[model samples]
Target: MSERVMSGSVDGLITLEAADALWADLTADSAVPTASGAFTCSPAHARMGYVLLGGHAVTTVSASGGQWSVLEVEVRRAAAALNSVGMDRRDLVRIGPFRGAPRLECDEETPLRWRQRIAGELQEPGGPGLAARRAAGRPYHLAGIDWRQMLVEQTRDRTQRTWWLPRAVVRLLDAAEHAETQWVQTTRTRQAGAAAAGAPAPRPYNEELRGQLYSVLSRKPGTARKVAGWACAVCRTAPAAVLDHCHEHGYVRAPLCQSCNTQERPDHLYSNDIRVANHYTRLFHTDTDDWLRHWHRCPGCRARTTLPLPHLAAWTAHIACRSLRPTHRAPRGRKPCGVLRVSWTGSQNTPRSCLITVAVDCCPSGEHRVLAQVSYREAAERFRVWLAETAPAVAAAAGPDRLDGLPAQLRPVIADTDGEGLALF
Candidate 1:
């Protein structure tokens, strides 16, 4: 027997001619499925059939009575089809009965009352009613015109003749009209209040100071209003919601959507253009010698040293100096006239060593022939010995009153006849 014969077994069930039409429209570009001539009384079956007509496949199914039921499979497929058309179960429930009806009745008495009841249950806040209505394909004369067009017609139609419209559409029209009326009333109320208070009539939004308020809040220029548009300045994609401004300065910054505006706090004063530019210049234009002197202080001896050019080499050189004495050999086999390594007692009460390399004199005209390195103590003792051996010559060379230029470390070793007697040690 055919599926149609089997459908007749269910009582009060109606044939689905509307579903067949939907299926045909949905599969217009592809091979059409063979008509099943299915009939259904259960709301679920009706809903599923309506969805299937929209061209979605059913994947989920349940079986009972020790046998697989084709009805359940068809219902699931119908549901999937409805989902594909963006209509959910709520939408299917609202319009399923109206499908393929002999007459379209949307008057206040019968259909409106029924539509209202369905809308109450289906269009609850956060429900799928709005989404389904939005997805309701192109409207036919039978289904009535689009809701916006219907609202315009309602205003023009003085006869008060009732017309069929989707319940969702009717609700939307009512809401829009209500909001418009409320806005008008609010504007009138504000105007009356201003007049009663002996104040000048309030200016229209266009006549008011455009971006002055925003500029003051954000510490920005009034030109920011020029960038006002649908897209947010920060994120670029989201729609703009408000003019972003500095809360402290009251200057307008830029247009930002709600999400972008609330995502981060305003930047500090140092983040401004002038300060940022100055900082960038200082960072990039700094002298290498200054940086080396500042950072290459010996951790053990507290003496400053020249740092190598490469950062890795500089670090390695620093580490080696901190822990070990220099080998007095020129790096990479570079030859030198002499290498001097001298050890001295540092302020930290530890022995510290330094290395100096001397180059040979190439010019015959030069008088200095040697470079000498000595510790502070050795230099002091040598100065004492030299002063004793050549007292008269030293006195004549330095002049009588000019010994003040002597180093602080060697001054005490030179005895002044006017102050104290010499004690050679």
Candidate 2:
């Protein structure tokens, strides 16, 4: 009969169940049955010499001459079972002749020792030790075994320090180390590239934007064309075919749609155009009716009436005022406050003059009320007089509590002043 010596150390200590199963299978084929049957070997004779070095047996075995035959088939079966639970030959300290006995070297007895060994091994330019090499070669039996748990296990015997680990667990650790190295390399490359291109280093989180910026800086035709076809940076409402950039600093800012790109002043910065566009966009969406109503209001005829399209066009050409929406609160159970605006007019013969006006829907009456219409100087003077007259009454009424029994309009002006006093414009 052809015979081959089959022996290897587990990376970590073996469990009772694994040891029992392995011993049972090995001696099952024996003709004579002892009291312990298959597990008739001591810690030393069984090739697990670590037991002799103070490690306790996981499974109970009767005292008998350790003469169990280790068939190649039985050893392979034991290896497979250990692998299934994330234990493999990589965990072995030594494996040789059965009679000579395998050496269970106890180098890394504690977690601190294991860590130190790993660190030292990694620092070496040469390949890893025998344990690491075997681990890398072993196949993963279980799909997602927790490699960390395999690294350390609680021993039943306090005397036993070092244990074996599976090859699969070692392979996982190798892969993790490789990934970290690759990430460091990639980050350094990006920083170098950014510095060469005179661009700011990209943030780690903004991967997409960083890539886009790199493409722009490198002047990649395909990427630039693709970027130009993307949605507008300003509104994101239309396809941005125009590439916008700062004239002073020659770097591409962003792709803006045709409309946004076209609305710019000759001498003013592009940011000014963006601000104006944003203001109008907000105004148009917020108060569409107000925009249309004031589009062609005749200054001479103060009535709130809509004009025909043709007349409205003419009226807008003649008008010098821009109407603004009121921000003040109206009395409860009343119509909303009306337009508060300023107008300016000048001619060859006339000096430039500003007209500040306030109009509102007066309480107790639904009629349109023009509260004030005065020159800028006159408005300032009136404001000063109002402040002087109202400051003392406001200070007297103001307390730690809400002012009770005051008119809604006056209460908002006094009590709800946000530390800046009455916000009436």
Candidate 3:
């Protein structure tokens, strides 16, 4: 339909038909992608609160306007104020200069409900969402929201650590990884061609690969028929989507997220390499695994502990930031946890591996010694008589991996009102 016709009336209020058309489009599919694609502003329009998303989703736009009514604000700042709500905002739409941009505040009920929604908005992808961000010492963004007239309502009484990976993001990550995994298989044929041709090198092939890669991988995606049980090789927070391959080797090295895929940092990648080297060593990191592992008897350092792991991380970092503080106190403010100190045993070890000794400390007053000594190869390689390959179970759960005996605070599934909390992401 023509923009003029869709606009309906001279007054800012959209024609009932335009509103109905928007509702129809949203009900059948979604208007989010339509708005996002066209979301932009020139300096002239920037003063009309155009820097922010006029409205990004069916739940977020409006005609009466609220904070978006302000002359200027950062986009991300405005995004904090905008989120999905139980009620619909697409039905009452106003127009912005771009193909789509709309803000809503026609009713006080929406903003009040919005506040309640933000408090409960724990599943925001790219978390901690605005709520969690505020809990983590970031400003709580409110649009159409005036801080002076209100009292603060913490989204959740307890601050939940990031444990549950948002299924929406996970779905995107899964597609990206699956597409790349397919690329890994398909490009084997193209590898020699691209490498041998040398000059132009598969630029077109690479572009085409990335373009097709985001069908389900895009922010607003298409069909997601496949999912690989893979997390981002780096952050592991979300699923890996980008296929990072060396041009010389046509096969893929790692699949990454949109953020990591774009911001190729040497330090972060280098840290990832080290993290990979130490991936098997589970005692150093902060996830529940590191603290939890110390609870039971390890064959290496069979000392039983007096405390639980947050015994030690939190109660499961969920909607409520349930801070599970340990009773034990550090005298000098050092971390009151086990000491996983490592020392190499000797150089005369076998050609395949060498030994290292770990000095362990189970937290009590003075000392009980339990040392875990393990082996590794400075440079490692493997030769196998039998070659076995594995693929992820097609029906495997795509949500966060299962946790056993962890605190309820860490469990996002505990707060699931929609029944999808425990299911695949």
Candidate 4:
């Protein structure tokens, strides 16, 4: 390999000279021949243990959109080359424009396509989705005709600190290589390898969220023009209002609403459980018949057995069913009762009969309670409250003006009814 070390900064960003040089050195080696007759590149270490190579290619016209057709052929050919060397497209961390421009949208789709494929292939492992990870802090790119990438091992542990890896070394290695595309022999001799196996590409959750978020987005002040242009053509909404990426879990969750900044679960129960429940009932109420059609299923069992539930007889009975459950032992907050319990006795003459009891005081005044059930509106209200407490940043971002500039497709999910709260789904 050549002894030249690539390094330095152009403006403030660390230049990738070493990575560029390494690409040239490695490609020159007979061991790593440039297979494609059109593509060219240089290699460098973009980050510690993260290698990068820069290259470009030309494409002949095809039936599909011109730009898209080139991207498909180039990426597929690149994937084939990488596979020959025991690496694959999944190893490609990012691809960005370097020299000649290929297409504008190609830069965005390259990373997205790679991520979608990786998510589908590694779906079973269940880590953070590539898009969310990149959104949080992962850097990947593809800029026009110039394709630049930082490759890393899939299973490598990243828990250790990266301070020891000098930025200069990575930059020095990235600057050296430059070449033209050429075809080489198929690197993968094994026909049964996993890399060759292909499946339908996975859909991006962020893209889907962008489309559904507009209902809320339209409400933003600046989005009015965008909405008018769309001809009211948008649909779909996420189950949660503020969509923040969860790095550990890899999916976005409801963070908060732009309007109320409420959490999904209400803390009002702490101040006055009965009062909050009552207030919720008055705001958006529902009855037994309403539940029979709408919300009767036990979220726990996924079963529609509300008819057999003896706890429906009284508010205390229903509360008892939720209280007595062992998992309900943890108190959400101060309440009239610490928990609820349900017990049953069966007889041949009668079907199973059950009773519900509150583990703590029902009320100090001993006032009789009325016949009422937990309303879906109440549940949604609590969700708003829960989101308020847990994701305050999201709550702050829910103002009417904050969403003004976003595209109609990127709006939030707004609720339909008055005081109905934000509809996430």
lDDT values, one for every candidate: 0.29, 0.31, 0.27, 0.26
Q: Once superposed on the true structure, which residue ranges of model 1 sit more than 4 Å away at CA?
A: 1-228, 265-425
TM-score of each: 0.14, 0.16, 0.20, 0.18
Largest TM-score belongs to which candidate?
A: 3
Q: What would the per-residue lDDT of candidate 4 be over residues 1-425, giving only the tens digit for each residue?
A: 34442232222222233323433344443222332212121111121112222233323222223211122333334334433432223212121111221111221212213223333333335332443244422322221111222223233276421111112212112221111101100112123245656622222223333312323443455432222122111112211123322111122222222111221112111111311223223212333232221111111111212222221222333332334423222357444342232222331113223222223323344433332333333333343353345444433444334443333332222222211111111
**Whole-model alpha-carbon lDDT for candidate 1:** 0.29
Q: Report the alpha-carbon TM-score of model 2 versus the true structure.
A: 0.16
lDDT of 3 by residue, 82-150 (tens): 333222222211110112111111222122222233334434565433443444323232222212112
Candidate numbers sorted by lDDT from highest down: 2, 1, 3, 4
User: Model 1: C-alpha RMSD to truth?
Assistant: 35.6
lDDT string, candidate 1, 1-425, tens digits:
24553463233222344333333333333321222222221111333212112222222122333321233335434534433332111211112112121111222211113233433433356533353354323121111112222221122257442223333343332333233333333455577687786643322122122223342433444333333334565456654445543222222334554444433321111111000112222211332222222122211111112111122112222222223322234667633232212222231112133222122232233332323333333333343343334343322333223334222221111111210100000
Error of 2 at 391 (Å): 31
After superposition, which runs of candidate 4 have C-alpha atoms over 4 Å from their true positions? Answer: 1-110, 113-115, 120-377, 380-424
Give the Å shift of residue 109 in candidate 4: 4.4
Which model scores highest in lDDT? 2
Question: For model 2, how does the per-residue alpha-carbon lDDT over 217-250 read when each residue is reduced to its tens digit?
Answer: 4354454455444666555655554454332122
Q: Report lDDT (Cα) of residue 381, candidate 2.
A: 41
Candidate 2 C-alpha RMSD relative to the actual structure: 33.4
The deviation in Å at residue 160 for candidate 2 is 96
| lDDT score for candidate 2 against the true structure | 0.31
